[model samples]
Target: MAKTKNVRQTALEILDAIEKNQSYSNLLLNNAIEKNQLPSKDIGLLTELIYGTLQRKMTLDFYLKPFVKNSKKTERWVMNLLRLTLYQMVYLDRIPDRAAIHEAVEIAKKQGHKGIAGMVNGVMRSIQREGLPSMDTISDPLDRLSIETSHPIWLVKRWDKQFGFEKTKEMCEQNLIAPMQTARVNLTRISRDECLETLKEEGFEVEKSPVIPEAIRVLKGNIASSRAFKWGMLTIQDESSMLVAYALGVTENEHILDACAAPGGKSTHLAEKMDNTGEVVSLDLHLHKVKLIRDNAQRLGLGNIRAITMDSRTAGERFEKEMFDRILLDAPCSGLGVMRRKPDIKYVKQEKDLTQLSSIQKDLLGTMAPLVKKGGYLVYSTCTVDEVENQNVVESFLAEHPDFEGDSSFKERMPEAVQPLINGFDLQILPQHIGSDGFYIACLRKKV
Candidate 1:
């Protein structure tokens, strides 16, 4: 007899792997989808189970704590299965609670022995009967907010300190919501209007992104399968991400460097902004990722991109000083900003990672500083809202290097909606502001 595949089982496997820090949510999901070749309905259900459980993990844990008979005896898979079931019971209105419980029991029995199955059934039935513990019971304000929003307590404290209570709460709440699908039009290949018409013609439920003129908000349909995407007319990207090339004040025929570029979203945007007239030398550490950049550029029909596999830290050695007209260091980050789209990120990132990543970000910034030509823009960006990785890194660099000053042209450079969010020369875009990913971008100009 052949073994049957189920979304719950696959979800548990991926969730367990995430707990062990094996791979990222997006990467794992894509791989699993391709491997199983499941129907579209099952794919949607699988996606919902994994992301929903991850998004409400802490809250689900709080609900399960009073129900589980023995914590130490429980296997990680059992715990994840329970989380998956409970998440559906609480969050997914379409799924009946009893149906979710019955599925959990079946999955538990198949994955483990009868004892495990009984335990899972007992816990789930009790949850359905007794109702979850009251949020009011968590006396501490921060503790309550953390559980309610399913964020870590330490992170809540840190963000509450950095952004104040109201904003922190809003950001945390936003993290649980599903991110909108948005894509950028490759203006180099086709006008945004033409791309919009093409996407509409392809039956995509889409509209122009209010955030950026070159981007569109996708309401329905897969952009990957659309003819416009295949024809190099569009690329799926976040509205905030679409702003990096603008922050550079990129102009036609200007040479650019995209340090730490992988998958080349911003690198391609830079090239498009330059109308494919000048070189956009993109660098990454891995050969496969360099190929992703090349593939994307090729798909977009952009010929000005030059992708190479090399550690971005070593980029200074490979290029002469003051070589590029502008440089983009979209540095590696804790990825706390994109949590809405990838809930597993909150679980994987630790506070210590911030300090470590900050050091690396500063080093990358320092290394690439000399490569930006006189008066050229050095646009430092990250998909994170943490102060240590954003402001502190840029501020420290500016203090140590007086030859570079914050480029306030970002006032005119960014879309008007984003100008007021600017801080000095940098902007910290909290995810709640525009339903976009939390992002930080700072423009610096090398003093003439």
Candidate 2:
């Protein structure tokens, strides 16, 4: 029989993989849990340890630095182990500090020499003896916030400039929170009320989303395992993302294009909104991702969606100009807005990535602009709140393309509750505002 790894050991291995291989924390942790076939309690502990360690990495490091005199000299795995241990000690109220220290030492001995184990024991003992350094001592406010929130200093500075210090601080604090699980009801097959009733019947604590009529927030229970999701009655999606298809406002028999569609959440929602009558052409850059769109469509019983593998930048070459009644450009973005779910993003993303992503977003808009029929609706959306990738990209596109103008009337079609959040034709839903992943949606209309 294979050795049964404890939660801390599993967490250590995951943290090591994340640092050594540049693996995503969520993906790696999930893969590990599934591979190990861990029970629910252990899985929960592993999740908490992995995500909490990654979420409070900088802060934990700040506390660990003074103890480990030569942090630079310490092995990467050792540093990660220490970070994981300290994370549990500082944040997890349930786990006793002595237990955390003992586990760290044991894991260190298993992975490294006795000297290393001794080093781990000494460092953890010192931390318990003397509490962490005061953040108030950090004179620079940005540095303090960055360390306190476990965000990169450069990102904090940028956000401070974009939104004032107080607002940025709130946003950073919000990023540390785990987002609520939200699912969109497939109204073509099941009404929102019916879906909510079914979920409740299955013992799930679900509530209607305040922003979108089709969305429901799951307060408890594994929504993915529910009968509603398995039967295609609900789609696991963020409330902010569910608004993209609504922003398009497609009608029956109206052709729509989902440019850069993949994993088909928005495309599937678009088809559902059309009552499964319109031709929804979904395009993706990769063949594998195109298959994902097909799978989602088949599962949802949505026949109107046609999946194709084609790059959005070259969409004009394959598709006729002014062909579709509506177009959705769910552009790729920095993904800063989703850090709560994917804490690894905070470490991997850099300031330079924003410039590169904005360039690609503008290119996608310019490339797909001609595909919209004259006076047709085109919705550009991203799972990010950065103005450079959202509002600025739309502003730049409108400046160069005189044939299209911002559509301010788009809000009238959205749920009444969300109408006030719309700015002109664009909506920037910050995570703190609605407890949803940060997303930006802009609607434009081609000139007749």
Candidate 3:
């Protein structure tokens, strides 16, 4: 029997890898793209198909709910096949409906029995005859958001309760569309203007990010595997993330500590902001992560960064108290902020994960507090908007440690538009409010 190969087939394989086993979407997609030697256009389609299906799983299931009952134990392969067809039928304009149905049946026939193929074809034809499921059918706001936006009900309910219904809906809808690939200009290599000129020369269109001076949003196309990116003219980063290193305000010859730094984006940016003249000790808990930081620094030609494998929770014990002039605690959290970029996060992260991560964040913040010298700066940032992991954690930390206070200087450092969000030094950037990723960054100072 001949095997069929197409974007849909590749997407199904990737989904199976993610569901039956534990596989990162990015890594699996990269491997598949490389192994298949797919054309650039097909590679793009494969990414869209895989990500779109995963991103809208709940919604697709909602549409399929009436078609099949007692679905709790349905075979995952059948479910994924139906979802893939529905994804193309609904989202992709280029792929014709009849073609989508035919491809789906072929895939089903290859993987399952004639009965499964019949079921797949029937359901898709029904959808093509009728329109997609209506929002009115689902009365519960959370359930409606879940089905409409293809997110988990628990997440929708949580957001509705925390951020109001309108904002919750907006967040869910925002995650469906692709995120802009933003990058921070490596001033050490080229100025922002110079980087923009270089990118334009390479046939890349870019627009300056409104939030950060050094960040540029890629408006027209992908730059992940481009020659300019390879040459280190820019590093892909969110505008909010680029602010963390800038908020640290590293100066020449100053000692800096990036506790919990991994993959070293912000740490390398800190070194760059310091003009590569200061010492930036970048530490991560895992050895592999340390290597990642080292690789990023090497690629960017950042010599000022020293990547180390260390647990940040005990940074004060290992490093001298008040030794660093500046410290950045890019604490790990639920990663709710970047949901638009990584759709799998909403499904993978649980409520318990946030609770457990908050405790660790508190401990790490406490342990790293003393590492900053008297009057030195400490920046605490997370890629999440949950109050438990954002404001509440910082408030609790300040209550426990009175010697450190929120630095009002952060307000002065932030752009005028962002300063109002600073409730006396704490900043919470909402996902929908800002086009950038939802990030919470607070600048604290140790009393002299």
Candidate 4:
């Protein structure tokens, strides 16, 4: 049997992985816990500590600034120790301040000298005596948001510019918190009710979503490695993502092209929506991703999906013009819409990536436009809220392809709460407004 690494130690390793190298917090954290054979309770603690520290990094540093006069690399372990302690004090309600301080001091004593340990103890005690830094004292709106919400300063600024102050702050706060585990019911195998019954029998808590019929949101638990998921009875997907395939309104025997499809979540959902009867050609730029699509489809028992490795920009070269009854161009974008799930994108993504991505989106839309059959639907979707990538890309595509027009019936298929967001033809799901992942979907029809 493997010795159990302490949760804090596991968290430290994860932070080191994220800081010293190129590793995603979610993936690395999951891998670390699994590899080390940590207990489930310790796994929870490790997750909270790692995610809390990363999410509140800016805020933690800001609070620490008052304690440390100058931000130099002095006693690195002490800094991380304080950060972990402060994270528990501020965010974790169960952890008492005294316990947090004691843990910090103990860790400090092990890692550094008595002087550094004393400093760590002093800082935590001071924080416990006083409290978190006041968000009001910070005059700069972006800086204030960064401190209050624990997002990076650069990310706060970008969101502030894009979404304005209030909306950006809300979005930042939302990202700091853990997202709910949402799953879409696999209709090809079982009905939503039947799936829920199966889940209940397997000792999983589930609640049906009021907004989406086939969407079920799992409350506060891990289901990624569950037998239900492995058997393809449920797919780990966001509620907003579930809407994408449904937005396409695919029917049985329809020829659908999922341009830029990979990891096959939406493509598989589309196949399920078609009752596994239609030919769903799932295309990806990379062969590995194409295999991923095939793997997902195979696991789900979705036989109608055909995974292909091809650049969507060259769709005309591969397929006949106007051949597909439905085409879903879920283009590649900055991935800003999924910041809640993948927080590191906030740090690494550049504004220049946007321009390049927008170019790719336009090229993809242009190439896939001719593939949609006359009177058939073509849905363009992106997990981004940027105007350039969402509505503007559609506008530019419509400018070039005069034979295509926006499908007005899209609103009819959408939930009541999402109806008003249907701006003209394209639906822009804002992160702040919908409590859903930031997404943009446009339904269009090829004119005969």
Query: Which regions of candidate 3 fall more than 4 Å away from where they truly are?
Result: 1-4
TM per candidate comes to: 0.97, 0.97, 0.95, 0.91
**lDDT (tens digit, per residue) of candidate 4 on 1-448:** 1222367766776776676675788899879877988878788788778877877777888888877755577555556677778888888898787877776676677767788878888887777677767778989877777878766676677767777988887787777767778888887888889888778777788889776788888875677767878999888888777788767888899999999889888999999988889799999989999999998899899999998988788889989988999999888898888877777676677778877899988888888887888898889899987777887788888898899998888888887767887877778776766567889899988898
Clashing pairs in 1: none
- Report the C-alpha lDDT of model 1 over 1-448, residue by residue, as the tens digit: 0122377788889998888775788889989999988778788888888888989999998999999877657888899989998898889899888778877788888889898999998898887789889998989999999999899988999999999999999999999888999999998778888888888998999888887989999998778889998888988899999889889878888889999889999999999888889899999999999999999999998999999999999987899999999999999999999998888788778999999999999999999999999988899999999999999999999999999999876778789888889877999999999899999999999999
Q: In model 4, how large is the Cα lDDT of residue 116?
A: 80
Q: List the residue pairs that clash in candidate 4.
A: none
From the highest lDDT down, the ranking of the candidates is 2, 1, 3, 4
Model 4 gets an lDDT of 0.81
Candidate 4 off by > 4 Å: 1-5, 74-78, 106-119, 152-164, 432-434
lDDT of 2 by residue, 1-448 (tens): 1232487888888888998888888889879978988988787788888889999999999999899989999999999999998988888899888888888888899999899999999999988889888899899999999999999999999989988899899999999987889999999888899999999999999999877888898999779888888899988999888888878988899999999899999999989888999799999999999998998899899999999998889898999989999999999999988999999899989999999999999999999898899989889999997899999999999999999999998988887867888999899888898888989999999999
Give candidate 2 regions above 4 Å deviation: 1-5
Which pairs of residues clash in candidate 3, taking residues 3 or more apart in a chain or in different chains? none
For residue 140, model 3's alpha carbon misses the true position, in angstroms, by 2.6
